[model samples]
Target: MTRLTAALVILGLVILVTWALWQRSTAAEARADLAEQRLAESQQREAQHQMIIDSLWDNARRQANQRRALAKQQAALTRIASNRLATIEELQRENQALRAWAGTRLPDAVIRLRKRPAVTGAGAYHQSVRDPQPLQPARE
Candidate 1:
């Protein structure tokens, strides 16, 4: 009976030790699983953050390129406008010189007729008879 009791007590101690070992292993596995999950979540957040930063940098580069192109186009347009203004001024000067030359070259009688206001119907025939010469084109 003493041997049987001692054997039972030893068997109970072995079972308790086994249960404690199992609990400790299970707890360790749970802790490792939690740490692994946390590591995966951190990696996922870092990937997402890196993607956002890369996208922002691309957008900034595109905007800078767009701004540079716009500035170049504006400068070209400004130069074109300035050149056009100079051309217009030159045309105006040429028109003034042509008018002055025309006044000097025209016959006095034709000039006087041009200065007179148009007279309607019955008076138009009298005016036409006074200037019977065929009109001539201006010399270039």
Candidate 2:
């Protein structure tokens, strides 16, 4: 081959190698950009998931606190009822008249009230207690 032909062939090979390297570099950059986008999306999804978990946890904590408060209230009510019953029994033991009253059966209206289903609120309880309807006979 002539010197000029050899030089031309060498130059063409150099250009081809440079073009291949540039294409590979561009492909690597594209892959890097895609990886970064995927990472950002994953982080956002994780943040949303964490938010849901935190909300659930807060709700659970609130329910537990309410349960504890209700339990304390129930204990206090039970103590008060027991004390009142004890006082009534002591007074009955000390007086003949009181013993006779304690021995008597509850009134029909009071018995019917005790047998009914529990009401929800204070207003509902008051309404139920004050209702003027006659009591229904108990089923056999």
- What TM-score does each of the candidates earn? 0.63, 0.70
| 1-140: candidate 2 lDDT, tens digit per residue | 79999999999999999999999999999999999999999999999999999999999999999999999999999999999999998998999999998789997878877877788999988988787775767665
Each model's lDDT comes to 0.86, 0.92
Q: Which stretches of candidate 1 lie over 4 Å from their true place?
A: 97-140
How does residue 119 of candidate 1 score in lDDT?
66
Separate clash counts for every candidate: 0, 0
- Single out the weakest 10-residue window by summed lDDT for candidate 2: 131-140
Most accurate candidate by lDDT: 2
Candidate 2 runs further than 4 Å off: 112-140
lDDT of 1 at 22: 100
Cα error, candidate 1, residue 34 (Å): 1.4
